[model samples]
Target: MTGLTHHFLKMNGLGNDFVVLDLRREPLALTDALARAIADRDKGIGCDQLITIEEPRHGGDAFMGIRNQDGGTVEACGNAARCIGRLILDETGKDAVVIETLGGDTVATRADDGNITVDMGAPRLRWDEIPLSEEFQDTRGIELEIGPLGNPIMHSPGVVNVGNPHAVFFVDDADAIDLERSGPMLEHHPLFPERANISVAEVLSPTHLKLRTWERGAGLTRACGTAACAATVAAIRRRKTERRITVSLPGGDLTVEWLPDSENGPGHVLMTGPVMLDYEGDLDPALLSGAAA
Candidate 1:
């Protein structure tokens, strides 16, 4: 793979940054090593995830493949969707765009406020769907607690799968707990078979929430769109917040709206946020060696 050079766009949704490589026309083989090389903060194009745009196999505009900084592939990444969607919209000059991912299809639209809105599809609430190691009648409050017996540091978290697994821990303060310490513990707990994104959420009001996420593979991130959606849905399920709410993250705010299921259709989660293109550049020829050498 020497002498190979690929052009990439650096983009971000809120602060969840990504390095997007369009391989729709010129396909390039991606491996875990290459993904890690691309995401290395000091040596390569730094990003939380490395996104690849490929020709759509289904009826969507394009397909997006996501790899975390750890070089692990995942089902979904909501913030990456908005960034890639904005790219497609700019190229085609269309208000709406469709993107296919390993998780499922996502529909994105350019909103009037100059932001992107993505329909993340319906969340998977079943225990098996979230792929927990065991079954639970109610995922809203699973029998899981941390710290001591009488005085637990974090308790019964709501679990959901918005394309991927997530565990939302509602707390009085989002920043009080040390996510770097607790996240890895909860994420690898036996309860979650496929592991899970760990979120510490504090309800600010009926319509507002403060959230922080420890992404499964990326660790602590400034923002996570799917985490926000999962947190909001978890809050609503617990009667802690409204269906539509604003979630504040370290990077910025995202508006999430969950429409209830009806006879006509199923439930859907819509996340709205901003995407910015930081720059465009070509990959160093030497970087690809990490994939094969």
Candidate 2:
């Protein structure tokens, strides 16, 4: 593939950055090594996740394949959906777009303020849906804790799955804890068979929260759209907040709303945020071969 150049776009939602490859026109086989090489901060394009846009398989506008910086594939990415949604909307001059993802189908639409709003679908709270290592009668607060059993530093995280599994721990102050030290451990905890996105959320009011996330496969991220969705749902389940709330992350603030489960609605989690197009460029094919610049 040397001497060939692949066009790519660098984009970010809030501050969770990504390298997007629109392979709809021409499909390109992506390998783990190539993904890692492309995500290398110093030697490569550098991003939190690598996104591949493909033709939709389920009657949607497009399909998005997400790979973490470590080159591991995962299901669902909220920010990426909004970014891709905007692309599709602009291309088609439409107000809404449905994006198919491994996790599920998400609906993205243009907001009144020009920001993108993605309907992340309903939260999966069943113990089996979350696929915990053990069965629990109630998933609102699982029986998992960090530190010593007698005096644990963190415990009883409210777990939910918004396309992917997540464990949200409500704290008095999100900045008080050292997430860099705690995120990896919690993400890999035995309670979660598929691992989890770890988050610490501090509720400032019934409608406001401060959050930080240790994303699985990716380390600490400035912003995680799913994490915000999970935290908002978790807080609502615990009666800590209302159905609608604003979650502030290290990168910025996002609006998360859990619709009421009514006869007419199934209660989907809606996430609204901003995405920016940083730049566009082509990848030197030699980079895939680890060649010198």
User: Considering every candidate listed, which one attains the maximal lDDT?
Assistant: 1
Model 1 whole-model lDDT (C-alpha atoms): 0.93
| lDDT tens digits by residue: candidate 1, 108-212 | 999868899999999989999998999998999898988999898889999999999999999989899899999998889999878899999999999999999
Q: Score each candidate by Cα lDDT.
A: 0.93, 0.90
lDDT, candidate 2, 130-153, per-residue tens: 879899888889887777779877
| TM-score of candidate 2 versus the correct structure, residues matched by position | 0.97
Error of 1 at 32 (Å): 0.3
If scored against the real structure, what TM-score would every candidate get?
A: 0.98, 0.97
> After superposing candidate 1, which stretches have Cα over 4 Å from the reference?
none
Worst 10 residues of 1 by lDDT: 283-292
